[model samples]
Target: RRADVFAMDGDTRWPGGCEGRAGVWAQLRSSGDAIGSARAARWPYEATELEVLGEGDRRVVEHGGFLRAVERFDHRAFGLSVAEAGCMDPQQRLLLEAGYVALHGAGARRSALLGSDAGVFVGIERPDWALRNARQPLGSRPSVFSATADTISVAGGRLSFALGLQGPCVSADTACSSGLVVLHSASYAIRGGECGRALVAAVSLKLLPNATLGALFAGMLSADGRCKTFDARANGYVRSEALSAMVLAETRIGGGRLLAASAVRQDGRSASLTAPNGLAQRSLLRACLAQAGEQRGRAHGVEAHGTGTSLGDPVEMRALAGVLGEATRPVQIGSAKASAGHAEPASGTLGVCKAMLQLSASQWLGNARLRRLNPLVAESVPPGRAGGWCFPLQPGQDALSSAGVSAFGYSGTIAHCILGAGGADAAHERGAGARAAVLVRHSFIWYDDVQPLAQHVEAAEGRTALRSPAAGALLALVRDHAIRGRCVFPAAGYLEMARTASCAADALTAAATLRGVRFLRPLLLDAAEGLWIACEVVAASGRVEITSGRDGAEERALHSACELVGALAPAAVSKPALPRLRAIAGSAVCTAALYAAFREAGLEYGPTYQTLGGAWAGDGGSFSVARLRRPPGTSQGVLIHPADLDGALQLTSLLSPSSGGGGGGGGGG
Candidate 1:
């Protein structure tokens, strides 16, 4: 299911009618397979067909002139050479960050740190830059073809080198499904016990200045961006460029297993080079389903290749409507081409990247544009079905089927694969299976005039603000991301439940003047950023507690927490009713933790140690044994009671350890 990190595919989900049933039946038959040999041939289109809810007739117009569109993220608004050569630069940059986030989420789940990376695998369609670099460097006049592959190799090299990966590096350009194919190679290599993990990148170059405009004139490009698949108005097709990448881990277990995936070749039955072939698509889908088995999520949501051209859309729909009988059919459907245009060589791989978001997000996000499908035709006539051949697939795993990704190349090459959500048990089947907790919350609080207090707070426990439920939930969200990312995280070992604190203008004034704390508004920081901050000492530990987010009597649990180590503060202040009660003795992480988090950041306090000298930051760590410095004629503040004497002695011990004679005698007049 969508929740399984690495699932198996037995019985699978196809569309309906003759097309769907025939395809599925063919797939339910494969042979003995090594760990993941079945994954090698699965096409991107196969996964796309698995759970196709409905079809979206959106034209590739959405991404037209996308080279200059504004970005959706505010954070990335800051200048960062996100794009590469041209229009493709922004798209590639976006894909890189998304891929990074996916991997980061995976690492967080297992408490897996990106200590050092190994290597990366990528798929490049038009390695023009690589060729360009080679041409610029050596002038590609006659014998410069050798640099073509070398230049493209730089794309994959960049990803691995940037992340500091040191393992093997490889790339694939299997036409349209190049992205999934790249993932296929990477996933298998990992499963075959090669590298620890693989970073898969899919990059395609946009049209060069005259090269593209000239291609359109050559009639190779779609005239009006109208990919009318099955419509009579269908012309040719427009080409788009984009870059996408995925981080796949063999040893790492994510939210769900990849289960059974297969992509069979059409042999010679694909009709024409770029011609639409239902039989070829059906053949590949059948092969995948045969290996996957019939499961509820057989055909969940399909990401169709509907380019809105009348001929293309209907032709693809005909294949779809043939499979799903309309009743128990696709629940949701969409198309990335509509969102980002054709993306050419990176098309197949980029589509798969989007699928990851849908599956991983537990939500079905697809193109809902375009007019409804026309209810007609002999092959599409299912007894009773018209809610919408492809509806918006509801978000969630229950609706996910053995996804099918379909890709057709200009060379008459067709590949299809079934991608299903592996069951949860399949993942826990390995390793210790101890769930790890990763937090992403920054609970900072800014105040003025409490510089010393703030310093003391961060020092003792590394905390800056009080605890809140939102902070707790934020930590949970971070954990969720890791679970769904790569699932390669080791059982969590660090209990980093810390808070963040800052000083505002008002509190800065009070602390500088040494005035006591005054009531003021505490600008609570966003509790979503769980302390990634280091504490000067240990105050954060005492105020906040990091547990498993479970509830019971959290005593021993709190005891083990890195943030609950201080209880002395409250204990010390509790003796107010005792008049001049003098000393304090307590055992708790919170008590002494106060001094630890701050003494280094520099906080002042009356000093008396065990007759030994020691300072937190600059103060010497010492123990004192000395007489009290009382007012001349009045013993107003001095209690002098038996307990008070001992308290005074302990206080003195902080400054001096013992009296000169070693005898414990101290009664002053």
Candidate 2:
């Protein structure tokens, strides 16, 4: 369930004026034409009335993919004041709204994301809004929020701040390839332990006059205002206005997984600064296929960066053909630009969304408005190449299990990513034997009789035994709480295990408090194969121990030991007064500084463990506020969340800072 949304000016016959995922899909499924005459009411100046010179010929800028009401936004929904919203760039606004919709589709609500470790990666190029505001009347002062609102650098930060995300926030500008580049960066971040999950978004809006004029002067804009990609009549691309967003995470909750590999490369010293390099593109595609390991040569389709430019299309086709030409079946090649127009920086991300849709539906929407195949493109891939390029003239069904997507920047940066359908869906399509083999290999089914904590538990006499598969959602959550660049199981997780074992052994419905808990060693999780965990509890002595080892190993080393006390009675329950502690504290401690100190001490904490929102230190003691960050819809049926408990334990650093040299020292608990 990868959440995705798109705002485009598509066919009016569809519902909601082609404003959502369904609308874009419908447009592609039907006529596959979203390009149309530019509206006079949307732009500040009438585009159809304006003429521009391209290649010594004057052409009217009459066609584009413009949204019906790009100006509409609910300021209150995002907690922005009207004045601030007014000054905010429409790119920023659209990104925020689109991000919310995407997250919601992935089952992450606004309330569930507060203090999340999810990262934000946005790809945006032009500063049209900023340029427009700079041309205000003489003596006009810019608003205080103008810098933040219009600046492209802060676009990702704004979304992170609004969602209360505590992970990495980055904004990239790489000309038209910005979107794919950010997607590449996000995937690397997740793999490199930067964030547990990420939101990748890209937007393009033709709001200023200079952009259009510059493209026209550079002979980039299509005179006919149509992107005839791969067609003999292709001249250039028509600029489009669109925004697309999707969520990427390690969990299977999303629509699909990034095939084992993706690659990014740069063209050095080409014919021109903006010229496409066939060799560089070929190298990039090879690198991506190499990274895919055994999955290489399995691509069933490709969403090409077909800008409809005569030079670019042929070069890209040659590179693609050289790398993917040997497939057993014809690779269905097409471009969304043929229908939606070129969205510039946002084009790459939009192409990814479309590819995902095609993979999910097992279909390919052919090139729109393509009258004839470009002779150069045809010549690039020789007739003898196994199943050469096949550009569909209409929508058709194809078993697109995996697809490749490409985006190249005029700046010479090139990115390519391979995507496979969701595991369950792909396995299903591969047949029952494949599905069973995958289940046996992973040892976990998404929807099984197993509970969240432990998959199986058995109680005999006073001893309790429990076994849980260390993968899927549990693995995803554990990965978020990385320690020192490694996915180490948190101490709180041990407590959770101890409590669960005690309750099961004692036949108690309520969890028992753990006493004398000790983490003997760190449990490191492997990226390829996570080992299963085994817990043993002695109910009579209230003793519990947990351990894990390589699958089918002879011995399992102890990782934790604890004693579970009986559940507390109603009279024994007590609540501490945080306001009283705050009154006694002397000075306030900056949360950011505290985390920085922790990082310097090699106690790195990700977004889930970054729970100390507010802290204060004094001679008497230290007071702090901690918020729990976890996956959405996972807070119920638990005595205490591991993240919340770990956060509270982190306050120990404030009590004995000199031990770790991490600052915020105090004596009182």
lDDT string, candidate 2, 1-669, tens digits: 222221111111111256555677887777566665544523423222243334333333555777655576766667888678777887787787777766766557678799988888899997788776754422235688877978888889989988899989999999888988988888777777778778888888776556766677688888888888999999898888778787777765534445445788998879999999999999999988877765543788999999999999999999998888888898999888888888888888878878877876889986788888999998988777778878998889987778888998988988888877654364432122411101011111111112435556777877898776677545755566765677788888888777777767765344477888788988887552747787898867878889886676778879999887787465676776767766777676777887787777666777766767777655634334333345543533344556667767777666545444223522111
lDDT of 1 at 548: 26
lDDT of 1 by residue, 9-108 (tens): 1111111110111232232111100111101211121121122222221121111322212132222322323222122222333334444544553452
Best by lDDT: 2
Off by over 4 Å in 2: 1-17, 39-41, 44-59, 257-259, 424-669
Question: How well does model 2 score by local distance difference test?
Answer: 0.71
lDDT of 1 at 605: 22
TM-scores for all candidates: the values are 0.44, 0.60
User: Total backbone clashes of model 1?
Assistant: 181
Best by TM-score, which number? 2
Give the TM-score (vs. native) of candidate 2: 0.60
Clashes of each: 181, 1
